[model samples]
Structures are given as structure tokens and as C-alpha cells.
Target: MAGNGGHLTPGLVNTRTHLFQAGLRGIGEGLGLLAWLSAVGEEAARLTPERAYATAAAAAAEALRSGTTTLVEHMWPHPSSEVHDAVLRALKDSDVRAVLCRGVADRADPSRRWGFDPRLMQPLEAALAHTDELIAQARGSRVDVGVAVPNPRCLTPKGMGAVRAYAEGRATLARHGVGVSYNPLSNMRLGSGIAPVPEMLEAGLSVGLGVDRAASNDTQDILEALRIGAYLQRAVHRKADLFGFPEMFAMAAGGANRMLGIEENPDGGVRAGTRADLVLHRFDRDHACLPVRDPGATLLTCGSSRTVAAVLVGGEVLVRDGEHVRLPSREPAAGLARRGSCGG
Candidate 1:
């Protein structure tokens, strides 16, 4: 019999991440959300298209290597078209499946109240036009362009109205169809109050997990987000098992597909005719070897990116033996500039 060295599971779908923040980690460690904004927002404002491209490359490589086969990147806008192009190029060059959400903040006035730079805001019309252009360019590509309203409060009523109108016309680009990436940890870390996950889920909306800004979470690991998300809810409700493995696993695995507006795969993930996104973790060794009594419990409590041994997406082996095998190169964005924006 051929022996398998690890546990096979669905490859995680990270619902949200600001890949550009990968380069801005640990900037405002002890500051609250407001103060952190002034420090970090300044860095965000200074990002050039070239820098954004480099950051996306570093982030894409990190996510793929860590067993995340599908990533939903919520990008903050840089004034340059090249920055957005850089992201597409990185994703294409890396060959990691992704949904690139173009985040827009039409009104930085509210952000200004928090001491953030006003320069970070893009005009509402320009933002929509850009998103439309990107979506048209992304047609038939693995990358999909979606609209992201970074913060509802950040926009004026007029700006909000504009977003609503633009979103209606671009309904196909909504996250997972009719869904939103909830980032409770990032919110709490910034003292931004917990996201209304319970409320949103109850309203019949498809809610998915997200790590939000890399600088906020300080790591791109989805296991950390899943565990922390469950813990926070439990602590809030005063119940030890307010959430369970099945719910969290679904969010990390097939939840995004709900928003993709695709039909459910009833044959099971490993069965024929189903999508081939999967991951293997080496649970037979080290810390992950704590116990196999309950696979879900073991996974949530002990698993981290370090335990990842392999990953497969759409039947392609992108990671093998804990190493990224299918990336364009070990170095980030090697010769990627020549590709010129990946068509979107």
C-alpha cells in the first residue's frame, strides 16, 4: 500500500487580505486604530505602482506557499494604473487562484477626522471607471475584478449613493455574489469594534472570513484567523462552543463559492466532477501530532502554515513537500515587469 504522510483537506479560501500591506508590517504596533492610521496611512499614501507590484508578489508567494490556494485580495488604491496592473501580473505570474477586489474610498474626509491623509481618497467617478475598465480587462482571465467599499462610514452620503449605483451596474463583481469578508480580528486590533458577523449571518447573507490588512493581522496565515475568530465569538457570547469546526471549515473552504454564484458540488470535494482545490498538512509529526482523535479539533487548535506539506488547486500541484513548486520563480516577481499588467 502507498502510504500518505499527511492529512488531506480542502485548500483554504482566504476571503480578504490587503496584500500591499505585506511590506508595511509592524508599523504601528502599540497604537490604537486611529493613531495607527496616521502612521500606516502615510505609508499607504506613499506607495508607487512599482512598490505595489513588489508587495503583491511577496504576498502571493507567501499565500501559495502556506497552502492557501484561493485568495480574495482587497486592495487599497494607489494613484497609478501600474499599481493595479502589478497586482494582476503577480497573481498571473504566481498562478495562484484569486479574486482581486479593487477597494475604493471616495471620501477621505472621514479618514481625515482620524488623522489619515486625504490624499488616499480617489474621486468616486474615477474609481468606478477604473473598476469597470479592470473588470472588462479581466474577462476570461483567472483574476476577477470586484468592487470593494473599504469603509461605509468613510464615504459621504453622496459618495455612498454613487457606490450603490455603481455596484448595481457591476453586480457580477460583488464578493462571492452576495457576500462580504468579515475581519473581526483586524477591527478589534484597531479598536474599530467587532464586525457584526452574527448579525450579518442571521440576515441570510453569505459571510466569509478575512484577515484584512496584513499590517493589522501581521501575518497571512488563515489558521490563525479561523482560531481567533472562533475564540472571539466564544468570549463575547460566554459560551465555550459558540462556533464549531464545521462552520469555520465551511467558511474557509467552500464559502467563497457561494458568492461566486456557482451551483453546489454535491458529489463531495474529492469525488469526480468536483473542483480539485485541496491541501495536505503533516499532522503525523511535531506539534500537529498532538492527537488524531478529532481531526477538526486538532486542525483548528494545532495547525499553522508551518504544518502545511502540500497544496493542489484545480488539479494542479502548486506546493509539494512544504515548498512552492509552480511559482514563476523563488524570487518575487522575477521578470514580471515585461508581462505588463496581465491584461487587467
Candidate 2:
């Protein structure tokens, strides 16, 4: 009977992506990272929570189809808690484990040089307060809240201090078990320099990965983030291979699981009893199999999300025939976009 059943595999983990920006897929259109953020941020204000939710759900479906089972979502709060709660309910409805990264903003950050007009950065207290509200709002929802500090470069010392304080506050509630995801490259691409990754890692924090907004990235691939992370450590120490490949894979795998803080322990590799999370490829047993003394090398260098065959979560086929089930409509966001770049 096990053989009679069609083969199923685990999904790829998309460490970071703004679900709302999936609409910006080709719309980025060559803008430099900073300019792109400016354009996209302005553009995103048009999205209603409903639209963002639908878009995010659709992205989840896409990930499942493209070999992503568990998605660690760094989503912005809705117009209200009810709206966010509804979104989480929808995530359960759609069948993907959602780890919502509740991010705090900092208006007083000096790195505002990255096309961040004074009008954009909301006051620190306002963001902190709202973030707290959102956390409470998300309570009891299928979605889990993981606190994310804006990269230090994205915030001034004062702003980062506030963010750190917020993280501390959340720790008291999530029982010091809350997870964290940061986007240093996004900060640096916007001329904000590296976030204090070393510091955060040292703070007894559950550090994880995320690419932030697509507008801030040249490429949205998780592999690129892996590569960037290694180079970043090297630049920090002027020593290449400082973190190394083993560390990078751990970041892509276990780091994401750590970010989710899933109840089931996560080794994140394709080992048995690890939630059946895996990505099956279309290799002819030669493409990725040949010269296979080093399978990890083949995947790290030549493996791509493109060869993904199916995405299974908890042994359920969320994706089959390369399509995610229960996708929602996105015409609203597109229609709103056509009307104006969010009247914000």
C-alpha cells in the first residue's frame, strides 16, 4: 500500500519574502534596491489586509506547489487584530504552517538615507504599541507570532534599543521561547550597513533567516540569502569561510524551524520522523545522483527549487500535479494597484 500511493516529498523553505510583493514579481523592473524599496513601500500601502491576506495565501499555495511546505511568514499587521486573526484562520484553511514575523519599525533611524523620506518612518512608540497589539490580536490563531527586530542598520541606536526592548517584552509573554528573524542584507542594500547579527545571536535569541521585502533584494532565492550570509560573516571578520557551508545549510533548514518554534522538533534535513518535510527533484538518478559521493554538494551548487516535484506537509498532499489547492483571488490587489499606488 505504501508503494501503491504516489510518492510525496517535503517542501522547500522560503526563508524570507513579503507575500504582498509577489505582485511585484516582474514589476521590480531594474530599480536599484533602495529605489525599489521606496517604490514598493509606496506601492504596498494600497493593499488592504484582505488583499494582502489573499496574496499571502496564494504565495503559500505557490510554495507548496513549488516544493515549499512550511512557510515562515513575516507579514505586516492588518488594519486591526480581527483582520490579522482572519488572515491566520485562512492560513489554517489553506493548510500551510504560518510563522508570522511581527516586525517593529523605527522612524528616528539615521540610516534613513536610503530613500526613506521623513514621511515613511512612523514613530517608534506607535510601532511598538501597535506590534504589541498585533501580538495580542494574533493570540489563539493558527498562526504563531515570532518577534523580529529591524536590522540595526535599519534603525538608529535609539530605535534599535526600542526594538530590543520590545523583543524583551515579548519574551516575557512568549516565555522566552519566541523566535527572531532579521534581514541584514536588506538593511545594507538600502545603505544601512550590517545589522548586529553577532550581537543578536549572542543574546540568547532564537536567530533565524528572512529576506525581508523583495523590493530590498536583487534576487528572492533562499540560496542567495545563504550565499550572502556566508559572505557577510567573511566581511565581518575579513576571513572567508568563517561560517562555512554546514552552518549555512543549518540556517536554511534548522534556522527556519527554529524560527517557527514548531512543537515538533525539527532536524530540517530529509531524515525520518522529521515531519516528512522534503523537496523531491526530477533528477534522472544521474543529474543529482552522479558523481554523488557528495550529494550535499550537488544540491548546494546545482540543485534548484525548479526541479521540485511535490510539497507535502504532515504527510498531506497540499500540492499535487504542481498546483496548490484552495488558492484565493488577487484581482482586488491588482485592481487597487491599477487605481493608484496606495493613496498613502
Candidate 3:
């Protein structure tokens, strides 16, 4: 790989996303968070199982093309088991490692004033039972299951306690510690407040980069996320040296693995004994990325899907020369267009 003047590094781990929103991209462009949720919820209510499968597959492929090996999908509340199954199947078929967080909202609020949309809510017991079924189905696959609440307002007191107990019983959060997914693009797009990354780092927290859902960020490009994440902190603090390339790269790659309980190469880097989830990039391929004095800086600033020559997950070559091995480049986009939806 070095013979061709290419750089090899660990693939990025997207800590949060909503893959189903691939079809809903560009729907609520200028709306605030609450208004945007209402707008997205209307379209989300119309999502069918086939649409879910197509959108999820398309979104996962987009993430992979941008050098994301693992994605954490935080689905919103929906009563359809078929829709959830379709999303899982799509991720499995795309061959990307994923944690499918089944969304649950116990509180019902018809008006967008206080709580989650009642149309998307299901009984807590039923949601838990369905999640168990999903776990059983995903046992031997590359996908995992977890619980997701849109926000604190979405959960009742009893629901919170039940979710807390369930999470504690299933995973060792206390042992591994907590992590934060710093989604700068999503926050900026939604007009949400900036995350105090420097302070978080000073306090010794593991922070990772996330493109979030395509609906909010409109892209799954981790390179862009890394660049924006660093620039945002620098702009807010008026300090150009706030976050160097190495720290930003770590956050993009494997900084949140401990929080996610990902045992494969917990501390992400190119090393022996780590899972071969890696990406190969050629700076010479892009004129803007040439003369790479610092590979990390070049990647964070000038890199895009065009610079990614190949991507490997678990030593398996899934993308070669910026194209997926098993999926046609146009299939995902065509699938969305067929359903009368546009890509973000």
C-alpha cells in the first residue's frame, strides 16, 4: 500500500445515526429542532417496510463509502415490527457492523408541544418483547440491538426505570464508562448549541464524531465531520490550536469504542491484534489533497469520498476504489428515487 503512496488507517465509527431518514433527507431544511421533528415525523409515519429496507441499505452504503465501518442507528419509535426487521436486514446485507437501537417512547403527545408523537409510540412491554425477538434474530450476524428514547421527555418515570434496569442488566456501562458522540454538523444544522469539546477533553471524557442522521446532517462523511468538529471548537474558543489533528482523528476512529463496549480494537489504530477495519486513501488521486505534508491534516481538511480508495471491515474488502464490492453505485439512489424520495 505504501508503494502507491496511500495512507492506511482504522475505519471510522459513527456513534449515532438514523438510517431510515435517508429517504427523508432535505425535507425540513430550515426548521428548528422541535418543528423539524414534527416535519420529519409526518414523513416517518408513511415509511413502509420496503422503503425502510431500501433507505437503510442506501444510508449504510453511503456511510461505508465515506470510510465508516461501524454505525449506531438510533431509530425513532414505530409500531411496526416489519419496519424494524427491514432495517436490520438492510444493515446485515450491506455487511456493515451496526447497533440497531430500537426506539421507544412511552409518553403520548398528539400535540408537538410537549412529548413524542403518539403515532410512533407503542406499549413499553410490547417494544421490549419485540427487541428481544430482534436480539434472537441478530445473534450470529454483524448487527446488535439496543434501546433508544428520543429524549427524556419521551419516557415516563416508570419507562425510564425500566430502560435503566434493562440496560444495566444487559451491558456493563459502569465498567466501560460513558462516552459522548459530538455531532457538530447536526447541531449546527439544527441550530443546537455547540458542544464544549475542550472542556469535555479536560474532564477526560471519551468523545467521538458522528454525522448523525442524513435528515439532519444530510451526509455520512466522517472526513467532513472531523474537519467541522475541529473548526467549530476553534471558532467558538478563538484558539486555532484547540484540537490538533491527532485528537480529532482518534475521536473519528475509535475514541467511543469503550463506551459502546466494542472489544475489537478498543483503542483504534493500525496495529496487530486489532480488527482489520481499515481504509486506504490516495492523496495523489485528488489534486486538492496533493503534497500531503501531514497525512492526518490532509485527510481531515481535504478528504472526501473521492479520496477513499478502499475500505475493509474485519479484513474483508467491502469497497474497492471508492465503490462497494457487492452493491452497484447507482442502486441505492435509484431505490430511493423509485419511492419518490430524494437523497440528502
Candidate 4:
């Protein structure tokens, strides 16, 4: 059989990434969440205004190449709606499947913030409406538009609720609900407190896992993200296993499908008949290293992006032997930030 070499496989659920900032991975030592954001490179600022598409596309290529099939981007500070659509198209340019979860960021008091873009409430409101309309329009089509509420530290409690309400409303459109994705790390890094994830779930919201961007996380590990979410829930509810491995697995795999609001027969375990988003990686060699017998434990603790060998998105092989097969973009966005764009 095929050993070191691999075959097309299921991909990961990368529900929260800045896409444009995909190049931003390693630059400084992260003491904690807050300290990491303080060290982010300056290239993020330049990605806005006119160069958003290139950035987003670069992120898609990075994820697609890394065996990530279902990518949900949360691109905030976008120049305009045209830029948002352009970025979405860029994600599709690759063989990997993508969900454009458009993110919006602004402050209640525009004057207090630093060099901050004025909280264009009307535009944001219009954009939210536009996302809903687009998702509906894209029914039964490839490349759908999902909604995302960007970093909440920029807003108050009312703002967080607004995000939740909008996401919940959007989820109900499909048979199962909406495909919801987010990054609490970005929010936490920006001094945003723990998201009311338990509250969001209580309110009938469908949420999923995401790794924000390399710039924010310093390192992108979905397993660590799952632990972060589970830890937060335990701290909040005082229950250790309220959100256990099974729930975490569901969140990682089916969360996007839930956000898509697609219905199923409930017997599939990453099987066929679902919108194709799968990743195949080399784990057998690594499995014997620790001398553990259970594969699930090995995957949860020992696994990282390095294990991924190939990825299939929408039945398309984006990553073969850990390489992206097709990407329409020329190259990663150009810049000076060592993290965001492959410039410096």
C-alpha cells in the first residue's frame, strides 16, 4: 500500500483566518495573548484600502497548500465592498474551498481610537445585509458568503450581542442553519475578553473553530484552539468536560456545514454526500513515535499542520504531497512585515 506517499483526503476546518495575513506566522516570542498583538508587524495596515484581494488570496493559498480545505476568512478593515468580493473571488481561484466570513471592526466613539477608521455604522449595517443577501443568492452554488463579527474589543457588550444576533439570524436561512466561524484569540489578543460562547450557544447560535491569522496567533494550531475554547467554557461554567472531544470534533468538522445550514442524514462520519472538504495526512509513522495505542489521542495532542499530506476541497485536490496544485494569484502579497506579507 501507499506509506510515505499519500492519497487525496479530507481537509481541515479553518473557520477563522485573516487570509490576507496568512504570511504572518513567526516573528517574535509571544508571552501571552496581549503581548503577541503588541509585536505584530506593520504590514497589516498596508493590506487595507486597495491591496486587500492580494492579501486574502495569499492566505487562501497558504491554507490550501497546508491541507486546509474549508477556509473561513475574517478580513476586517477592508477597503470597500468591492474589495470584499474581490477577496472572495481570490479564495476561489485556488482548488481549495473557502467561506468568506466578512469581518467588520469599528469603535462606538470614533474620536477616542488611534488612527482608527471611523466606525461607519451605516456601511457596516449595509454590509451585514449584503452578506445575508449574497449567501441566499449563492444557494446551491460554489463559494458562499458567511458572516463574521470581527474583534469584539472594538465594541461594547451591545456590540457583541449585535454580532451574535446577526450570526444567529443568518444561520437560520439554510436547512440546518448558518455556517458560523470565529477567532476568540484575535479578540483576546486585542484585549477582548472571553467571548460569550456558552451564551451564544444558549441563544441557539451555531459556532465553529478558527485560528484567526498567523500574525495574531504567533502559531496556528486548531487543537490548541479547541483547548482554549474548552478551557474557557470550563472556567465559565465550572464544568470540566462540558465541551469534550466529541463536541470539539463536531465543532471542527461540522461547524462549517452547520453554518452553511445544510441538512444531512446524520450517519456520515466525514463521509460522502456532503459538500466535499477533506484532508489526508501522514500519521501512521508519527503514531508509533509516542508508543500510544489510540489514534484519537495521538491526533489531538501530537498532531500539527505538518502531519497533513493532502487535502480535498469540494472534491478538488488542492494539496498533493503538501503542495498547492492550483492558485490563480501570482504570489503572496508584497510588504515589509515579516509576519503578514512575505516582504521583509
Candidate 5:
């Protein structure tokens, strides 16, 4: 007997992802960070508008099945407006609560530079205009809008300041200070130095977990990321207890919820008034739980995706008995890939 087992709690929130990149996983193997970015960026640039819709739809389904009720998707630099529409349609149809971070890569003025495919760049002004259009339309939708800037090293000080200003504007509307969700695993994989998460958290900046793009992370498993995050930090600090299972769990679940402005109970999370995003995990029979003492600890160190049993958002069961509730497809958005150099 497996001991009639399962446990329920607040659902996990993936604070950052690039759902459209699900189709491009594992292409950058054996490549250095910059080389990988260029190679993958070029391939991502080749995605057509139709392909974007399909990829986003598939990613949403995967997230739901993995017990993620809320996701913050950092969109790629989409060329077609119809592609953006398709993304929104997918989220709405999937019933996943989300924050859509609009991607911007400017390439008109050589002074405003990033190390990405110039082919995908749009004029900064035009990009902002398009962003505004999307944000305006996102009102009353399940999706909210934020800005995704080129990496700091890819921009001038002035350009970085401009990106901050844009992000701050969204902060005002969201009623929370602008904070960043980051992917340490992807950063290390790409030779990007680890973000100063502890320092930022100490300084009161909201930091959350991100699985990044599929090509970058190769998978969208937030729980696995959670375990890696703790181990990575502990190893970096050369301290056995630097980031324990509890802290990382808080980061992926409650900590992320806080950054998104989701309310929490003093007792912990998911009260009557708060959004009802939650996950259930079963570990009784799994070898990972053989000698389980602390469930959270066992989950962090021993569990895998198979541990997840159920997921819910806003009190609606999205996954039950370990299966996703299939949603009917809606009208597809226009297109996914574009081939122009516009800048904002």
C-alpha cells in the first residue's frame, strides 16, 4: 500500500519564463554563453507567427500539468503584433494567471546596443508604442504587462536608465516597487555571473525565481530549479546551510507570490480572500521519500516532477488526479516570427 498519500498547499508561481522558446530546447549544447545566445537567438528569430502560437499554447499546457498555477512569461522579441495577440489568447484560454513581460531589443542607434540578433531589433520609440498598445489592450485580461530590457552589459548607462524608467511606470500601476525575477541556473550556464540575490534581498528588492527560455534552461521545471538554486548558493558560499530547503521553497512559492503582490496569511499562504493557486505533492512510495523525515526537505533534495499531483488557480481545478483539464482552443493570433530591424 502506498499509504493513501498526498498533500495540499499554495500552488507554485514561476516568476519568469519564455514560453515561446519551448520548441527550441537543447540547441545550445557545448556552446559558450555568448555563442549559445547568438546561436539560439538566431534560431528563435526564425520562429514564424503561427509557430509562436503553437509553442505558447504547448508551454501553457505543460506549466499547468506541472502544478504551476501562475506564471510570469518574458516574451521574446516578437515582430508581429498578431504574435502578441496569440500569446494573450493562449493564456486566456489556458486559464493560467500570468504577467507578460514584453521583450524589447533596440538596434537603430548604434549607441543603444545589445548583443542579440539585430534582425529582431525594433526602434525604441516604436517598441514603446507597441508595448503601450498591448498594455492598453491587456486591461481586464488575465495577463499583465511588464518590460524586458536587454542585459545590462548590452546597454549604455543612459539606455539602462531608460529601461528602468519604463519598468518603474509598470510598478506604479501594479502598486509594487519594480523588482526582478532572475534565472541563476541560466546565468551560470551562459557564463553570466550569478546575480547578487542575497544583497538585493537584503536591500529590500523583491527577487523571484525564473526558469528562463527553454533553449537557455532546457526545461521548465521550477521545482528542480528550486533545489538547484539552494545547492548553487550553498556551494558558492562554501557554507552548508546558506540556502536551506525552506528558504528556496519560500522563494519559489510564497516569496514569488509576495513579489507579484499576492496577499498572504500570517499563518503562511492562500487564505479565503487570496488567489487560490495551490499544488499537491505525493511522495509516500517514491524512493525519494523512503526515509523521509522533513517533507519539505525531502521534496527539495529527493523529489522530481512526478511528485506533483494536483494544481489549482483561483479555486478552479486545472489539474486533478495528475491530469490536466484540456481546454478548447480559441481563435489563433495572426503570426509569430518577423524579419525586420525596428527599434525602441
Candidate 6:
């Protein structure tokens, strides 16, 4: 394929997402975190295996379309193995590299103010066993399994010990080095305060961009996350020079690889020995991106999914000419919207 006057760069890695919430988009508008979760929980309670497949596929398709080659799906606890299996199938079918984090929460609260929603809570033993099962199922695929906990408050002392034991040598923050998933859009939408990204960088912490979930973010567009993440820091610090385009671009691409235990490219670019997870963005194709002065600055400021000419994951062309190679031409999210009445 011809470059066609496009810029080729490393594909984005979305550090955190709840893909099952794709069907629950636009549920809790204009509400804070606690109130929003209450509203979303009602929809979450109705999740089925079929719904999980459709929503996760739709979410993964959107992420791939927007140049996110990798995603970390942070699934909340569910008793049904079918639902988890459906998510894994969707991700594998989408051909996006993923870490499926099966969630566990022991402290259940009906009100969900201080603890996890009881409807989604399961026994820690069962959750750990299920995670192992998922890991086995994903052995030879692009998808991998990990454990997810909502927060420290959601776990009991014993539950914490079990979770720690489970994660002792696998995907632990201390072992792999700490990383932050900076989700600007979700934080803004939920009225969560801005993350101290500048401070995190100053402290030499690895930080990566994330869209959070379709429910809170309403879209899995990592380009928007990249732009907003940098703008927020600049506006708060009252310094236009806070985060440069190259630095923010790195964060959007491969900055959190260490956190996820994925090996980073030697120089973090299209080098001889690097992985072929790449994106080709055409500035000439988009009016907003035309007359590009600096490719990095223009991409950070004006690039959208529409400007992505192609996306390659592991040397496989998943998206060519801005369309997913395997997915149908019809919008994947359409199925979720049609089934919206199910949640209601």
C-alpha cells in the first residue's frame, strides 16, 4: 500500500476500559461518580452472554477503528462464565491485543457507596478460579487474562490476601513497575477531579492514555483522549509548554508497556526489530488536518479516526482505508442501540 502522504506511527494502547458498558452509553449524563454508578448498575444487572459479546465486539471495533491496537478490558465481577467467555471471543475475533482483567470484589454493599455492588460481587475463590480458566482459554490468542479489583475499599482483609497471592508474580504493579491510566474524558464526565499527570511525570511514573468505557466516555476514541489529556494538564498548570506532542504521543502509544508487562520497542517507533503495531494517518485526507506543519503537533491537535488510513497489528492489516477488514460495513454499535430497551 502506498503511504499516500501519510504519517506512520506506533498504534495507541488504551490502558483501561470496561467494554461491557458499550451498550450502556449515555445512561448517566450530568451526574457525579456515585450517582452515575447507581444509574449504570441498573443496566449492568441485565447483562447477558449475548449482550456481552455484542457490546465487547462493538467496543473493540471502535477502539481498533480509532487506532488503538491494544486495550486493557477491566471487567467487573459477574457470576456467569458464559459472559466472560463471550467477551474473550469478541476480543479475539476483533484481533486486537488485549488484557482481560476479570474483576473480584468481596465487600459487597447494596448501596454501593463504600463497597461494590452486591449484584456483581462473587466469592474471591470463584473469581480467582474463573480467572485461571480464562487464562487457559486465552493461551494461544491475542487476548490474555488478569485480575481486576474495583478499589481497596471493595476488598476484605482476607480477600486482599487472596488477590495478592493470585497476583504475586503476575501483572503486579510493584513487580512490573507502577503505571497510571490517565482517563481524561471519563474523569471530566463523571465530575472526577483532574489527575495529577504533570506531577506523575515529574515523579518519573509511567502514564498511559485511556478512554475508560463507552458508558462514561460514550466513545472509544483514543485520539480524543490524547488531545484532552495534554490540554487538561496545560490548562491546569497555566503553562502551554507542559506536555509536548511527542511526549503525549508516546503516552498514547507505548508508554505503559512496562505496567502491562509488554516489552517496549527499543526506540518506541518504526524500527527494524519493533513490533508492527502501527497506524497510518493521512493529513491530506482530512480538511482539519491539512497544511500540516509539524506532523506530531497536527496529529495531537486535529487527528481523528477519520484521518486514520490504515491500522496494522502484529503485521496484520486489521483496518485498511479506515475500515475494519473483518467487521461488516454496518455499524457494530447499532445492535447495542437496538437492544437498549433490554437494559431499561
Q: Indicate which candidate wins on TM-score.
A: 6
Clashing pairs in 2: 10-278, 11-67, 12-67, 12-68, 16-211
Segments in model 4 whose C-alpha atoms lie over 4 Å from true places? 1-10, 23-45, 48-51, 65-67, 103-108, 111-116, 119-141, 146-205, 219-224, 227-244, 262-268, 284-292, 327-344
Q: Considering summed lDDT, which 10 consecutive residues are worst modelled in model 1?
A: 335-344
- State which candidate, 5 or 6, has the greater lDDT: 6
Q: Give stretches of model 3 more than 4 Å off.
A: 1-3, 172-176, 264-267, 339-344
- Across 84-180, the per-residue lDDT of candidate 5 in tens digits comes to 7777777777778888777776543332234446666666666667888878878886677777755655445665677667766765334556566
Order the numbered candidates by lDDT, best leading: 6, 3, 1, 5, 4, 2
Please identify model 5 stretches exceeding 4 Å from their true place. Answer: 1-4, 108-115, 152-178, 256-268, 285-287, 327-344
TM-score of 2: 0.64
Q: What TM-score does model 1 achieve against the real structure?
A: 0.84
lDDT of 4 by residue, 1-344 (tens): 23344333345576777765555555444445434443442444344433555556666666665555666666665435665666766766664556667665545333323222343333556767667765665556456676655455555566556666776565453344443465656555555567777677677777777877867664455646655666676777899767775666566665555545443212214665666776665665355425545545555556555666666766666666555666523455352233434333
Which prediction has more favorable lDDT, 3 or 5? 3
Pitting candidate 2 against candidate 5, the one with the higher lDDT is: 5
Residue 7, candidate 1: Cα error in Å is: 1.8
TM-score of each: 0.84, 0.64, 0.95, 0.66, 0.82, 0.96
Residue lDDT tens for model 2, 1-344: 12222223334455566665554554545556555655665555455566556555555555554455566666542234443444455566667766666545553322344313344455667656666665676666445565454344556677767666666565432343545555656666666567566666578655555665544664445545656766786798788646565655655566645435563333345666567665555433235434544545544444444444455677765654445545523432342254333332
Error of 6 at 21 (Å): 1.3
RMSD of each: 4.9, 6.0, 2.2, 5.9, 5.2, 1.7
How many clashes in each candidate?
Answer: 2, 5, 0, 14, 14, 0
